[model samples]
Target: MRHIVIRNLGPLAEADVFLNKINIIVGPQSAGKSCLLKTACFCNWVEKRIQLSQDTDAFKENGVFENKFLEFHKLYGYVKEDSYIEYENDSMKFSYSWKTKVFDFSWKEEGRWNYVCPKISYIPAERNIVAAIPNWFEVSMKNDNIRNFMKDWQEARSVMTEDMPILNLGVSYRYDKSNNMDKVTVGDGVVLDFTNTSSGLQSLIPLLVHLEFLYTKRFNTEQSKNILRIEEEGTLISIIWNYAKNKSHGEFNIEKVYSNFTEMKRTEVFLEEPEQNLFPPTQGVLAYRLMDWARGEKGGFLFVATHSPYMVTSFLEKDNENDISLFFNKESKDGRYVVSTATEKEVQELYDYSIDLFHNLESLG
Candidate 1:
């Protein structure tokens, strides 16, 4: 299990969360739902950087850490003088404070550090723009989240060999590599340009494409090991050399490190607004699909920040055997947001809110 504690960060006053395999955060706009998820993403990135460098002083300069982790996510502005964060998992522990400007990290055990480097992907809420304009990354966009998503979107499109179905939607998305175009195939043989598709699909396609691509690429143990071996050749060499030196000193078992590095990789995805431009039924289906991906034989972690009641309800109402946590964020009396586990009463509140919205719309008719 993983745990996170945040305080005085952005719109969030306090958030203490014990993360599960599948975690969902739901709240009104500006209630710190996305902030919580982004904070987690930043913490994970920090962990990865420290592991790769094998140095706690990897981010010796606070400016370097802020720019790479906080500024990249446009979260620097949210940091107050007293902002503080701490994250811990099976492998390592990380803590940082804005007031003190101190970053503290430690491995769980003496020598048995979990060497699995996660393959992480962040899907932004603005992903529809990536689908609408596949070349958007070429434009001058300062948002790192969307830009990163576009890169993955392009790669996913290039690798897709056949049409991929849209859940609960009677359409399949196809990419024409030769023509460098995207098309949507309807029920018969009719195909239309992707840009001419519905808004719902325009948003859903990018999310699904990247989700499927990353999962397939990361969950395949043999394939992922080979790819990582090639890409992290230098890092692996350094790690092995250090392990061998430590073994000669009778420090620890080198074989255990190699075993962990080779076999323990997991995929982590931070998805924003997964119910974007989707209908209620389609949102439910999407939730189910996402849950399945996290609960697959090859385990993965999914963290979603969403506003849709349908999306939250779908996940909450599922017959889940795996660990799943639903967090609800709301404004407290002190004008700060607090996040806590969703209770049955909170779930009913969401249902009532949805019904009130529908009734308000009915009055116009």
Candidate 2:
């Protein structure tokens, strides 16, 4: 998918950075890279196609009827004090056009308006995995709709015990005897804890679970449409159970393929700076693995807003085409910020500089 254009965005007076599958937004601090990612997240929220919602009371109490509003608002830099959003779509060609109006404090003065929203996930630069992990979990939980929609899983709950060590280690929800209610855990050696894991583990756990749940949910739902009973020989449950149980160690590791979605996920995962807590080597590894998974898993797209040259170089080394789009924001004479793209040669040069800097740092160590 291509960005096509973005107008009247934060500090971005008017800029257009066309996008590809693996698009990269690189720029100095406060260059509107995060702004672009937010715009894509907002678009995805509004589109309603990607089901990311919450089943919590805070959402209902706020009168936030849909999850899109919440997800759209999570993106910083968009003038949220008072804003109006509008957009259009052309499904035949799989393209969209969107506009959001950011009103100033007075509501009368126009802050900024952005056009073009894509199905993007924006991982911020600072990483802030601790704070971000919960939000990701919320999104994943809502999308999985496991709590509300997956009746089979709900029924199977009785057959399964919440006491399992692995179940407690992974992120999930459980019931409390004292309150007779459910609680979410973050895999910290039982005790229904979410704080013991490292920030990296916490952040990645939700993403992994979400992907697994999404594929599982879709496969079950679709298979049920075609099959009737639980046949011992060839049934949906057996198929998914075998598939999930047989997943391998690699990045894209499913033993048996159930549906087309499994073939090519094509999900546009937006990450701001995935290398927040990771060292240079680990950073490159994570970025490479995630991108490779997207390409191989049919999980189509990945849009990243990053300052780490190591991550960008990792993508470049993979020999993917214009898949990585670069953006740089410049201030105009009038004190306005404008976003622009870096040429292929410019990006490569920047990568080289980053590599040299990292190598020098390594030498110092």
Candidate 3:
């Protein structure tokens, strides 16, 4: 398990999140749940970059460090020196000071926790927008999360085989590129046009394929190349992940691997509102499937920010209570944001609230 603590970061006045194999964050809108997840993502991204640089001089000599810090500052807006982030495990500590931009990383007995950086990803609430994309053309978006979503969507579409796990979804949609335009087929019918698919599926495909992309990466293999090249668009974290996986395997010719690559990444994904547009049963399926992926062969970390009680209670009901950590984000009477562990009874009513709405997704959701 790992621990993350944040002070004076965005709407998260003071927040602490513990990460187990599977971690969940639930709260009302504008309660700073997304803020906490994003902040943790940024810090985890940076730490892995540091680890990458430490393990390989090519990464350091190439100026990836300065580039990453400047990029993070521009993208995340590290407000002040007063705000800080601290991450730790039993044997190691990773700390950063936003005001001064200093990092301190230490391990009690060297080489104990020099683990590969988990592949990091986030599924934004706006994922459905990618399905709106036309067959041959790409959509333009300024938001980082949205851009990453589309990039992952395009990559997943380009590589997926007919037997991909996403095909198991109740209504699996496959991207057909041989058609006049990029087309999608749901079941045996004419769902080739994404506009014709249900909003629920449009939202689910990216999440499905993205996980497929990540879980397939085998960092332990003897591959000729390490990194998986993606469009230059999207988060630096993805870039860092590509670089780290490459470095972990042994040094490689950057220019040659730059254009070609193999494998999935070993990293974490921060999922926002995974329950979006999903029915209760599918919501439960998505929740359990993500956990299975997190603890699967690839084995990266998983963090979820949600409003659905089904996403919460389903895991509890699945008898994974001991392996997961749950946090409830809420604002107090005085406007201070507080995060507390959720109890089973507390989330039961919340699950009931969400389950009731599933039958009425047309009017609800």
Cα RMSD (angstroms) for every candidate in the order listed: 5.0, 13.9, 8.5
**Pairs that clash in candidate 1:** none
Clashes of 3: 8
Candidates sorted by lDDT, best first: 1, 3, 2
Off by over 4 Å in 3: 55-81, 90-92, 110-114, 135-143, 163-170, 179-182, 217-265, 343-365
Q: Which is the leading candidate under TM-score?
A: 1
Error of 1 at 252 (Å): 7.3
lDDT of each: 0.76, 0.46, 0.62
**Model 2 collision count:** 14
Per-residue CA lDDT of candidate 2, range 1-365, in tens?
44445555566665666666677776566766776776665555443222111112232232242234434334334543323333333321112222222211111112111112222343433333323333433443333222222232232222222532222235463334554332345535345333355566445433433333332333243333222222322443354455456555552323333332122233556666666655677667667667665665445667777677777778777756556666666666766567677777666666677656433322211
RMSD of 3: 8.5
Give the number of the best model, judged by lDDT: 1
Give the alpha carbon lDDT tens digit for every residue of 1-365 in model 1.
88999999888999999998899987778989888998888888787766655667756576566567675687768888998889998778888888888887778764335566677788888888965775665788775777787877887877665988888678898789888888889777789888888888889988888778777753552443355555564676567777577555666555666555645466788999999888888899999999888777544789999888688778877745747787877677888888887655654555557645422321211
> For residue 125, what is the lDDT in candidate 2?
38
Candidate order, TM-score descending: 1, 3, 2
TM-score of each: 0.85, 0.53, 0.72
Q: Which stretches of model 1 miss by more than 4 angstroms?
A: 110-112, 217-256, 259-264, 343-365
